[model samples]
Target: MIADTFLIVTLLAAATVRGAAPLVLAALGGLFAERSGVVDIGLEGKMLTAAFAAAATAAVTGSVWIGLVAGIAASVLFALLHGFACVTHQGNQVVSGMALNITVSGLTVVLGYAWFQEGGQTPLLAPGARFGPIELPGAAALASLPVIGPIYREVISGHNLLVYVAAAAVPIVAWLVYRTRFGLRLRAVGESPGAVDTAGVSVSATRYMALVGSGILCGLSGAYLSTAHHASFIRDMSAGKGYLALAALIFGQWRPLPTLGACLLFAFADAVQLRLQGTPLPFVGVVPVQLIQAIPYILTVALLAGVVGRAVAPRAIGVPYVKER
Candidate 1:
């Protein structure tokens, strides 16, 4: 009984981490954008574009690395477009983002049907084209031990490279945001572009850089969705993960570590929902699939309703900087 209980806990923990990986990557990407005073409502669009590009490229090239690059390139292009409109033209950031989202949503489907004719999805990826789980050294040997062994083998090992990248990204982003020179400039620009401008920093440049970083991270998230997590790109594969990531960002007040916590919380809800599907309870019997699926979103709404704390955004977020003569 104890062993069975341990196995269940191990599986749940692993699922939670796997589920949280993409959210962590996307939320951190949003953190960079919002911290630099740009509201990136197009995260969903960029992620979908990247997922399609990555899957299509991998299916054709038979190389997941190449597919990852393609995904990053596609996402970066969208990010740059957002920067061009919002930063260069001084356009309405929200409008530009929504337009991009709508455009990508439709464009990907059209292109998928035109090229692959698989009903708006890329071909199923071959084994070599998708990311495969890597077993850490001694994972086999350590699996026989008690207690810690299951945790290490299941939770700490067996994930693909992107999962590790997502874990590492949190600390790296924290250091970049709080312990680096560019981070200071980025934060200053978000809080007060005028002050950053007065201090000889180009506000536009900083924000654009931040968006680029955002694009790269979002690309990773998308690539993970299609190549690492799923075998192919389906229509609207990103769903609303980008928006959830944004919510996690706001929940964490745009901080990297706290944002990670929020992501884990959502992921836990998701993992539980997956486990609870068709589960019979004392009174409920079998839970409805729709209700099971809605658990994560419901938790998101509850948290945003001030269960955690008040979330204060950057002062200059969504306000384009107009330089003084």
Candidate 2:
């Protein structure tokens, strides 16, 4: 009985890492665009479109890699749409992003049915077509260790390659945003596009590139959702995770490492809820399922409302640049 309890605790801790992957990845992508002076409210749409594309492509080609590529392409297309609207037509950024979200939510369902005839979802794939765990060196042996080590080895260590990529992306993006020439121009444009424009960097081009980069990361996150997490696609599966990611980014002050930590906290809350559902705890009796589900969101609201100070945004964010004659 003691062994079983110990194992359960380890598994739950590992689940926290798995759950954090998507949120961390998506939030990092959002940090990229927003820090560079563009607001990508369409992250939900980008994720949804990528999920559907990945599932459908994987089903057809019997290769998860093809599906991943397709997912990135789909996200890039939608990102471009947002870019065109905000950059060329000078449309409202919030409105444009919301429109994309609604569009993908409906369009994917409609088109999914047209192609698959399965009520808006694609057929499941065979073995070797979907993403599987990577057997890291000594992972299985490490899982036998006591306490936290087992969970880290078994649950967190064997995720798809994308999870590692997502984990690495935070630092890479953080460095790009804070330490590079491109990063400087990106922030400059977001803060004062007039200055960046005067310096001969095309404001529109920088914004467009940022949006496209955001789309690619979002696409990778979405692919991990459908292919790595569940091995299937469902309409509206993103389920406002994108918004939660945005909140995390803001909560972390738009920094990558802190934002990833915030995402993990949210994910850990969710993982703990799931782990506790069937377990018999000592002090806390079986809590209401609804209450458990609300923990992460409650934390998010409380943090935003009570603790976090006012976050600073880019000066030129959401505003189109017009050069003076």
Candidate whose lDDT is highest: 1
lDDT (10s digit) by residue, model 1, range 37-154: 9999888988998999999999999999999999999999999999999999899999998998899999999999999999999999998999999899989899888877789899
Candidate 2 clashes between residue pairs 3 or more apart in a chain or in different chains: none
Candidate lDDT scores, in order, read: 0.91, 0.83
Superposition TM-score, candidate 2 onto the true structure: 0.92
Q: Per-residue lDDT of 228-259 in model 2, one digit per residue for the tens?
A: 78677888989988887887887776778888
**TM-scores across all candidates?**
0.95, 0.92
As a whole number from 0 to 100, the lDDT of residue 156 in candidate 1 is: 95
Backbone N/Cα/C clashes per model: 0, 0
lDDT for model 1 comes to: 0.91
